[model samples]
Target: MFRTRSDKVSLVMGHVIVTRGIAELPAVFFTAIMEAVRRFDDFTEHNDPHGEHDFGALTVSGERIFWKIDYYKRGTEEGSPDPSNMVLTERVLTVMLAEEY
Candidate 1:
């Protein structure tokens, strides 16, 4: 599934308890999502407790998939800043199936 990283992906043949920014993906996926938004008229973002800032949920062949981002709020030092906002202190994108976790 990660064949389209545009050479940004890193492969690791090991395990860890936690990791950050270890995955790199292509921007084309986002383009496709924007296309889907224009075509399907689906809302692309949501707010929640788990830091899921910009959330993209799509259904394909009866399977639900998601694309989302986590961000840090600039001032109060809080997590889960909305990715659409221009003032995020940090941002990270994530892609996964609904049931993967």
Candidate 2:
């Protein structure tokens, strides 16, 4: 399947939720996420080159943040499903606090 780009990310929080598009991703924040991903990939159990990202949690800027990507195994219908395609679609990243769902 062809890889799809993350056009934006949805943020889910305990009290409130928000969103941040790819264009709005702060460079510093993006850097932090990349660092974490790199570290995760280096771990013995996550060494698979074709591994797909599922969940991630880390502290950046003194804030504990968690993230998960929803892959659209099937295309979006009625604006539901975070990531909406057949087999693979745009992956929507859901970011939130550690305590939030």
Candidate 3:
């Protein structure tokens, strides 16, 4: 989810949460997320190459300082009965205005 706040944006998913405000995040954080995603893809390709993943954003709390994110995977096939297709994978990141109050 992506939320715009007076000072920052909050991104939440499951038990993992990340907040992006008017300040910059550590470079290591960005690097870690990218690396994890890349590794996940590698693993998934070996285990389930035909699986597809997606991420989405939602607004909450008057569209200020709060947002929700939903990540999940689905079968690559147009129609499949794989339960993994309905599972949430993870929340990647949240972005906020750099100059917002």
Candidate 4:
């Protein structure tokens, strides 16, 4: 699968990894993710281990998928604070294919 970005937020947009299996590479799965993000209008932001803004989704092969939506406020040391920023909500959708024998 490929990655997509909708906004220019460098640290809070388009951060998804592909994994799980081949079946998860379909367009439907990606679309579902988009839908989920749309449903929510806000998100919470946090500093990751690296101290950088962490936002986006990640998937692992033969394991599971994860989504991270973040929301927070930032401003200059003297300037007024900006409005709340919302990151996209991320998650994994399990699409079952035919069972193998």
Q: Which candidate is the best by TM-score?
A: 2
Better of 1 and 2 by TM-score: 2
- For candidate 4, give the lDDT: 0.35
Between the candidate structures 2 and 3, which one is better when assessed by TM-score? 2
On TM-score, the stronger of 1 and 3 is 1
- In the order shown, what is each candidate's alpha-carbon RMSD? 11.8, 9.5, 15.9, 12.7
lDDT of each: 0.43, 0.47, 0.35, 0.35
Which candidate achieves the best lDDT against the true structure? 2
lDDT tens per residue, model 1, 1-101: 11111335532221111112112224565445434522332443343444332455676444455655445565554873563454554444465546664
TM-score of 3: 0.23
Q: lDDT: which is higher, 2 or 4? A: 2
Worst 10 residues of 3 by lDDT: 58-67
Model 4: weakest 10-residue lDDT segment is: 92-101
- lDDT by residue (tens digit), candidate 2, 8-88: 543331111224432245888766754554344222345333445456667666656666655543445233343433334
* TM-score for all models, in order of appearance: 0.37, 0.41, 0.23, 0.24
- Candidate 1 vs 4: which has more lDDT: 1
